[model samples]
Target chain A: MGVKSTASNNATIFCNSKRFFRKLKEQKYLYMMVIPGIIWMLIFNYIPMYGIIIAFKDYNIISSFFEAPWAGLKHFSDFFKDDWFPIIMKNTVGISLLKLVFGFPLPIIFALFLNEIRNSTFKRTVQTISYLPHFLSWVVLGGIMITWLSESGMINELLVNMGILDKPVAFLGEPKYFWWIATISDIWKGLGWNSIIYLAAISGVDVELYESAIVDGAGRFRRMWSITLPSISGTIAILFILAVSGLLNSNFDQILVLRNSLNASSSEVIDIFVYRMGIQSARFSYATAVGLFKSVIALMLLLLANWVTRKLTGKSLF
Target chain B: MRRKFLARRTKGEVVFDIVNTIIMIVICFMMLYPVWYTLVNSLNDGTDAMLGGIYWWPRVFSLDSYKAVFADSKIFRAFGVSFFRTIIGTVVHVFFTSMVAYGLSKRYLMGRKYFMAMGTVTLFFSGGLIPTFLLYRSLGLLDRFVVYIIPAMFNFYNLLIFQAFFREIPDALEESAKIDGANDFYIFFKIIIPLSKPVLATIALFTGVYHWNDYFAGVIFINNPDLQPIQTFLYRVIAETTSVHMLQNMPAGIRTTSVTSHTIRLATMIVTTAPVICVYPFLQKYFVKGMLLGSIKG
Candidate 1:
């Protein structure tokens, strides 16, 4: 019986191998098409993931990557003990939370209001104008922001003229206002573009629902509240989950362009900190450890948000 | 029926529409004013404009800043770099990604699930900054033009979009080509590509814009000043060179110059942004459609 079972198992494995080889040969051209992308993935994506082991090592420029001495948890501990830890965490979380609070709902509200516009030309014009900022790189927009918020610029000039301020103030130069500036500018840039998803979702709603609500004596606001809002709640929920997961991302491009020596205290986030440490200061291992830390926390946040949303709304990204 | 529905609009509805329209107008102004203000300043005489209070239009219209920006060899080189990168990057990215997507679209293709799983993992995590920097360094991509093209070759999200679109193409089309003795490459380059023009344009525009706007590559990978793109050049001009300290420390005599760096800065901003703004109106519908195709689940 043992001999017979062994022979059967060997025969099954041989058959599977033969079939796999035949399948591979048949799809050789398809494999040729796909292999380049797979190679790119291995080199650019997977290799870096493997290289993340340096986060545990005491890596330096002088030493080869593999030759670097292992110092388990040292870099991470050092990062935790670093004095900039609290400040960076605060700024990262603070700016992100501010953006989430102000930036998230404005788009939905904007879309809702834009939907109510009866004139197609007027609506199209507003959308076109609004989305213009989104296409501009943060560098360009940051440059514009700097110009407009300078003491001699438009915002200050307007305020001084309107008697809102006795003097022109450099808004970006003030550390206290960095969070607000970042949050507001982020919303400004994304408001129209972000609303596109919500608007698409709203458009998909059954028009009969709105007609029925109107027939039931529901007013415009009532119809909006009951029909429009509920119809697009899935999109809202998904976006909210994404926002929560991305709480650590402080819009690194915006921060890089906007941050200066003056607002460095308020502007420094994990991403910038990592860039500074790794590239500027050449503390590669420490920066890698910090980046890994952030990535793990971000992954955790995404999973947590996905799980919670699934529990609450029966919807999840995964 | 719609006219009847419109006629039934309540007093509250009328008020809402009025308020909403006003708010939207304000929003539009808010969106447009910064760019307009920059344009006015760029076209204005630099020294005179610095005296402030020039809001709506240029107080002294002058093209000196634009002339200066154009004459500068460095800015011209940067523009060339930007133009080439956008063109080449978009073409390569579209062709390569869509080709791969074509292969993956076929369920019968061997190891399709594994390839997908590999891509899906990258969407969630990465090797972070230092390792990527080191990897690029070792790969001899640093300070090279190909760095822009190679590392950015495949975006997994874009691949998924292409795959989705490719799957919708009728299988009979490919089968007929196969029976005609046309190889996969021939079919892909001829039939598949021509039929996929809309998605191609959508992806091309996205990739082109990305290549045009990316400044981080200049900041990190490329050290050669000549290789820096226009956006990075603008970043240096606007962020680093025009710091408050420099502006404050500038000798009073320099202000007398017809084109100070300030106006030049504004001019450069407008020049860099002009292409985007010009194409925006025409490409706006495609962008909207692309955004929907990307985000909306069937």
Candidate 2:
């Protein structure tokens, strides 16, 4: 009886292997199509994962990756104890929060206002004009901003001519004002582009609800407050959750382009700091440690936000 | 009496329309003022531009900036490199993205779930820049044009968009093609490609924009000045111009003002950004449709 049972088990295993190979053959074309994508991910995404070890090593180019001496948590400790840590963290969090407060709501408000326009031509024109800024690179936008906000630039000239101040305000140079200027400019660039999604969601709202609201003698404002907002609440909630996930990311490109020595104190975020330290200074280990810290926190925030959203609204990102 | 009531209501609506028009015009000006300022100042004489002379219009208008930019051989070379890179990179990106998206859209594909999980993992958690750079170095892609294209080939968001579009394609079509003895390649090229033009166009536009605008990858990977793309060259121009401004403030012998730097920088910006901006309106219809379709699946 024992011999028979052992033989049967072997036969079953053989059958399973055969079935797997047959299925593989049936789906060969599908596999072929996915080859380039898989190869790309393996080369670009997965291969880079191996370099995370440099975060724990005293990375040196001459010594090669495998020979680099291990530093354990020394890099992390150095970053934590660094003089600029508190200031960098404060600036990053503060600027991101300011963006969250102003930039996040502006698009929603714009979408709401746009949804009121009955004429499609006017709406389309507004959208096209508004979204143009988003496509412009930070390099281009930065040059334009610098030109417009310089001492003798348009804004300062208008202010001086109107007698708003005795002299041109140093908008970009003053550290205290840099954060606000950065946040506002960021909003201006993204406001229209960001509203595209919200507008799409708003357009998907059932027209029957609006028609019924009108029959009930509801005013435009009343209908918007009642039917429109609630209908798109899911979209808002999802976007809000997604936005919260990236609370740590104060756009590096914009900050990098706009930063000068005079305003570096207020403008420098973790990304810029990482680029400066890692790439510029060649302190790979310390930069990696900082980046790792940010990534871990970001991942935690995303998971927590997703969990909370799922629990409250039964909607999760995954 | 009915005509009079209609006329009164029309009058009221006209008044409301005028108010709306004024508000919209103000918004439009606010949107366009910076661009206008940059364009006007770029064409004006550099000194006049610096002295707050160009407001809504150019003062002492000249094509000297354009002349200066054209005179720089580096600009032309950079533009050529950029153009070539954009075409190749965009094509490779679109092809791979569409293929993987189509493959993943099929429910019967083996390990589809695992592959999808891997792709999504990349969206949130990257190994950061050091790891990525080290990987590129190890692969001998450092300072190579492939560095730009390879690293950017698999955009998860674009893949998702394509996947959503592919999923919408009727399964009957594929089945019928198979029954007619057409292979997967033939089906994909003949039927799927024809049906997928809208999404393909959208992805192409997006990928093209990314290639045109990106300077960071070139800055990080390409150390050779000869290989530098237009965006990077434009950045160098701006940085050099800023440094020149600083030099101008220095004491006696150190100060050497380059009068044309400002104009040159502005002209470069126009040239670099113009192509992308010009193509945008042509693609606007696809942009909205693509965005809407992508969002629905997400």
Per-residue alpha-carbon lDDT of model 1 for A1-318, expressed as tens digits?
A: 585457557677677788678768878888899999999999999988988999999998878789999999999999999999999999999999999999999999999989989999999999999998888999999998898788878889889989999998888889999999999999999999999999889889998998888889998788778999989988988898889989998788899989998888999999999999999999999999999999999999999998999999988787
Which runs in model 2 stand beyond 4 Å of their true positions? A1-11, A63-66, A310-314, B1-21, B239-259
Q: TM-scores for all candidates?
A: 0.96, 0.92
Which prediction has the highest lDDT against the true structure?
1
Candidate 2, residues A1-318, lDDT tens digits: the string is: 585467557677777778678878878888888877887787777766667778899997667768999999999999999988998999999998999899888898778877776578988998888888888888788777766666656789888989997899767777898888889889888988888888988988987787766657666568778988888777877887778878888787778767777788898889889988988888888898888888888888888988898888877777
- Tell how far residue A219 is off in model 2, in angstroms: 2.0
lDDT measured at residue A3 in model 2 versus the true structure, 0 to 100:
57
Worst 10 residues of 2 chain A by lDDT: A1-10
Docking class of 1: medium
**Stretch of 10 with least lDDT, candidate 1 chain A:** A1-10
Instruction: Show pairs that collide, candidate 1.
Output: none
